[model samples]
Target chain A: TQLLEQSPQFLSIQEGENLTVYCNSSSVFSSLQWYRQEPGEGPVLLVTVVTGGEVKKLKRLTFQFGDARKDSSLHITAAQPGDTGLYLCAGPFTGGGNKLTFGTGTQLKVEL
Target chain B: DAGITQSPRHKVTETGTPVTLRCHQTENHRYMYWYRQDPGHGLRLIHYSYGVKDTDKGEVSDGYSVSRSKTEDFLLTLESATSSQTSVYFCAIRGIGDQPQHFGDGTRLSIL
Candidate 1:
C-alpha cells in the first residue's frame, strides 16, 4: 500500500501555466522530499521539508509542508517545457535510516 | 545521476531466470536503498542496507533480496524473474540515516 497519495496522476498544461501537486498521508513523517525524474534518469531531489508549516522555494518552484507533517505540496509558478517529467514525493522512514516510502508519482507534461 | 551508479542500464530476461542488479556509490554513503518504479504504483522500497553486511527488508521485499558486503556497494537479486517484476529499479545513497538521498540513473528490466 502506498502511504502517500498524489492528486491528478497525469497532467498536461501549456507553458506559463501555474500548477500544483499535492501529496497527502495519514501518518506523520520525520521529513518529506520532492523529486523530479526525467526519462532514463533517476530522481533528482528538489526540496525537503522537515518541519511542519515550513515553506521552501527554488527558482519558480515552491514547496510547502503541512502543519502536521502528514502532507505536502509542490507548486510550480509559470511552468515550462523543461518542467515536464515525473514528480515524486517521498517520506523518510519514521524510525530508521533514510529508507523512503515514495508516493504514487505525478506525471506532468508541459507544452511549449 | 549522483555518485551512485547502477550497472546493466537495460536488461531483457526470460521468466524464471535469475538476475542481479548492482548499485555502486563513490561517496561512501553509509545508507543505501533499492526501489522499484512502476506505473501508478510509483516507487516502492524493496530493500536497504545500513552498513556492511547489514541489510533489511522494506514493504515490497517479497521475492527480492539485497546485500551490502561493503560500504560502497549494494546488490539486489531476483531469485526468479517474473512478468510482474518488470520495472525500473533505482539505487539511492544518503550521507546519514535520515538525510536526503542521491540516486543513480536506474536500471530498466524486462521479464519476458
Candidate 2:
C-alpha cells in the first residue's frame, strides 16, 4: 500500500496558469517534504514542513502542511515551462534516518 | 545532485542477466537510499542503508537486492533482470537521521 497518495496524476496548462497538487495520507507524520524532479534526473527537495498548519513559500511556489500532519499541498503561481516536471511528497519517519515513504507522484507540464 | 553520482546513466540488458547499479557519494554521508519510479506509482523505496553493512528493505524489495560495502558506495543489483524491473532508479543520501536528503542524477535501465 502506498503511504502517501497524490492527486491529478497528470497536469497540463499554459505557462502563466496557476496550479496546485495535493498529497494525502491516513497516518500522521512528524514532517513532510515536497520534491520536484526533471526528466532524466533525480528529484530535488523543494520544501519541508514539520509543523501542523505550516505554510512555506519558495519563490512562486507555496506549500502547506495539513493541521493533522497527514497531508500537504504544493501550489505554483504563474507556472512556467521550466516548472514542468514530476512532483513528489515524502513523509516523516523516526530515528532521523532517511526512511521516508513517498507518495504516488504528480506529473506537471507547463506549455509556453 | 550534491556530491552523489550514479554510474551508467543509461543501460539496456537482456533478461536473466545480472545487472548492478552503483551510487557513489563524495561527502561521506551516513545514510543512503534507493528508489524506483513508475507511472502513477511515483517513487517507491526499495532499500536503504544507515551505515556500511547495515541495510534494510523498503516497501518494494521483491526482485531487487542492494549492498553497501563502503562509506562512499552503495550498489543495487538485479539477480535476474526482467522486463518488469525496467525503470529509472535513483540514489539519495542524508547527512544524518534527521537531515534532508540529497539525490544523484539517476540511472535509466531497460531489461529486454
Candidate 3:
C-alpha cells in the first residue's frame, strides 16, 4: 500500500476557479511537504509544514497540515493556467533515512 | 533550479545493460537524493547521501546503487537495467537545518 495517498487524481477546471487536493496517510509524520511539477521538469518544493495544525500561504496557494500530522491539503484560489501541473505531498520516511515518501500525485489542469 | 544538473536528460538502454545517471549540484549542499517518478507512483526515493561516502538505501533501492564521492556529485547506477526500471529520475539537494529540497530538471530514462 502507498504510504501517502492523494485524492482527486485528476482535476480540470476553468481559469479563476478554485480547487483543493488532499494527501492522507495512516502513519504519523513529523513533517509534511507539498510540491508542484510542470511538464518536462522535476517537481519543485512548494511548502513544508512541520507543526501540526499549521497553515501556510504562498501567494494564492494555502497549505494546511492536519492536527494529527498525518495528512495535508493544498488549496489554490483563483487558479490560473500557469497553475496547471502535478501536485504532490510528501512526508519524511522515518526509521529508514532522510528520504521522503510521496503521495500519488494530483494532476491539475487549469484551462482558459 | 538550485543549480542542480542531471546528466543525459533522456536515455534509452537495453535490458541487462548497466546504466548510470549523474546528478551534479553547484550549491554545495550537504545532502543529496535520487528519486524516480512514475505514472501512478509519484516520486519514490532510490537513495540518498548525507555526506561524502555516506549513503543509505531508500524504499526502492533493489536494483539501484548510489555513490557520493564529493559533496557536489551524486551518481545512481543500475547494474542490470530492466524494463520495469524505466522512469523519469530526479536529483535533489538540501542544505543544513530545516531547508526545503531543490530539484534538477529530471532525466527521462527508458529501458527497452
lDDT of each: 0.91, 0.90, 0.92
**Looking at model 3 chain A, which ten-residue stretch has the lowest summed lDDT?**
A91-100
Provide per-model DockQ scores. Answer: 0.93, 0.88, 0.86
Per-residue alpha-carbon lDDT of model 1 for B10-81, expressed as tens digits?
999999999999999999788889999999988888998889999988888999999888899999999999
Clashes of each: 0, 3, 0
TM-score of each model, paired residue for residue: 0.96, 0.95, 0.95
**What class would a CAPRI assessor give candidate 3's docking?**
high
Candidate 3 residue spans exceeding 4 A from truth:
none
Candidates 1 and 2 compared by lDDT, better number? 1
Candidate order (DockQ): 1, 2, 3
**Ordering by TM-score:** 1, 3, 2
Clashing pairs in 1: none
Report the CA-based lDDT of candidate 2 relative to the real structure. 0.90
Tell me which of candidates 1 and 3 scores higher on lDDT. 3
Q: A23-96 in candidate 3: lDDT tens per residue?
A: 99999999999999999998888898989999999999999999999899999999999999999998887773
Candidate order (lDDT): 3, 1, 2
Runs in model 1 lying further than 4 Å from the true structure? none
By DockQ, the best candidate is: 1
True C-alpha contacts between chains kept, each model in order: 0.97, 0.92, 0.92
Over the true interface residues, superposed, what is the Cα RMSD of model 2? 0.8
Pairs that clash in candidate 2: A96-B97, A96-B98, B1-B103
